[model samples]
Target: MRNVAICGSHVKNFISSPSFVTAIEMDGVPIFCGLIHTEDIKFDRHIPENRFKVLVRKIAFSYNYRDKNLIFTTAIKAALNRFYVVGSEFVGEVIDIGSDVTDFQIGDKVIGNNHYPNSGIEGVPGGLPSNNSSTEYQVFHQIKLIKVPPQIPDEVAATISIGGQTTYSMLRKLSLTEGSNVLVTSANSNTSLFAINALNKHKVNIYATTTSMRFEKELKEMGVKRLIQIEPNSENWVADELAEEIVKEKGSFDCIIDPFFDIHIGKLIPLLASGGRYITCGFYDQYSSLIGKEFQYRGLTTSEIFVTMMLKNIQIIGNCIGKTEDLQNAIQDYASGSLNVVIDSVFSGKQVGEFFERTYNAKDRFGKVVYRYD
Candidate 1:
């Protein structure tokens, strides 16, 4: 059988575990290099189910210590170390299969939904659908292989996999009934726009913020009741009167969809109703560690989100897309024209450095920038 090949580019080398087994040699000698031997992974169906799950655990990462320091200002730099390691999330096709492997065969195109929770940048990683670190062909578990849907384009599917799944998980936490007043921050974003598209069927009153007049106009055309464009440096906009005006006009948002973390928890804490919920899921100039710690320290309105859960009957939730079912549903919605993929721009893999440079530095672009894999 001819082994499939895959490759990707990154700014740094990926480091591998020292104890991983080796089954192949390069230039007549074994070496820990870019290539991994498929023979190293032996699938044993005879093993007990507990042992199988344990083997799965062996393939996963356990980095759960909540150090507030790991969060960085840049996404690519935060992932610099992970670029070398080949794990189950690094998708590889099955060139040959054992008789017991009933689910896979040769020539099958597949991707691994890394089944490890919070292994990627931020706390967004979850099993099987959360991370998209699959930039190359490497050894992957058959259990992790999810066939690409026939109707969906691979690039769009890849783009939606993480963001779509995260939104789906958030929706599970919410009961977005009709007539719910919702204030959606970063309404011009890829995930935020998708969230708004998802909420379109409900009788929810929509209020959104954008920095671009063009995007605000586009969102207003999509049915947002009111769209506010705030300058990034506008200090006058964050004062008490503006918040009060928002409260009076919107009748206090029953739920806020904040993909952008710009509105500090303290800043918007008063805008939520007594039993309301605030959901944040986007990457701001800072990461969750900074926001999480600052909100905990400020004793400001954020205290209600973190502490009032036990005392004030309110809820604050963080959202990220996570679930094959949700992805499947989202695909259907996209096919039927209910959900949309707002691609701001596309960059080739070689141009990804420039892409990340702009994404991290530019403060104006509203849609997602994606790389088309060759």
Candidate 2:
């Protein structure tokens, strides 16, 4: 059996292991000898499918920052038992089916997502793929997999599972309409980008926040009227210039889609309209170095923040991955060309670490960063 694993130390090694990936040369194959352990991996031809394997040849898989951080978490280290598969999104075709399986046939393309339990977004506990998409082959339950329309390419279809669903769910939560004044943080993120593009026809007045000007031209093309640039290290995320511009132009945002809730949330409360909505699909500040910091409140420390939130008559909604039906509808949108999934780059097999690293250093990519398998 063949599979790819994102290696990390066992909880037992957490005390002594100084590093995660300690590669040692052996027979020209690097074996992780420290916190992580990598061994020779080979695939099987008797790919027995108890009725569920995506594609005969996995076409592609995209990178999500959560996948990398998940494997590094102390909880994940212990919960995953020994090792962790590194991807939550998978795109491929049905090459095999188990004896009683009747939902699929050979060559039917499909997309699947990893289940996030206990997430703020609240979705059915439909099981996730048994392993991450970093492997050449993965066997997931039939219920979690959604068949993709033939028109959607493998790369674009790959995103419908996670990014698309998350965006769709957040958009619907915002209840956006024509002339809705909205603000989206991390405008270059795949989730944020998809959400913005999906709102194109709604005639919404879009304001975006980012630290980079690299995507300024593109985001403006996407209809973002004003952009707020915030540094990760800056305490004043909503700079004075942006605040003045907002006061001069739009009084308050009717909706704010934020992922950096840990850092910039203090600035958002004052910007929300009387009955505006503040929804977060994720919090990046909480994703600290797993081996470095303990899991605690990395975002908001003051109860006053919540008090202000409530006093403003604002709604604070927490989101994770979307519902199963949301995933299906996202695929339909991608298939019908009602949505677009932008991919930054593609990698090939055996580049697991490379894939994670590229996504980690994504300062210039506008959309998704993906990898393919032959």
**TM-score on alpha carbons, each prediction:** 0.63, 0.79
Global Cα RMSD, each model:
9.9, 6.8
Specify the highest-TM-score model's number.
2
TM-score of 1: 0.63
Worst lDDT 10-window in candidate 2: 26-35
Residue 254, candidate 1: alpha-carbon lDDT: 84
Task: For residues 240-268, write the lDDT of model 2, one tens digit per residue.
Answer: 87668778897888999987676567666
The candidate 1 region of ten consecutive residues with least summed lDDT is 59-68
Local distance difference test scores for all models: 0.50, 0.66
Flag regions of model 2 displaced more than 4 Å: 7-57, 71-84, 113-124, 286-301, 349-353
Q: Which residue runs of candidate 1 sit more than 4 Å off their true CA positions?
A: 1-134, 211-214, 230-245, 260-263, 282-312, 319-321
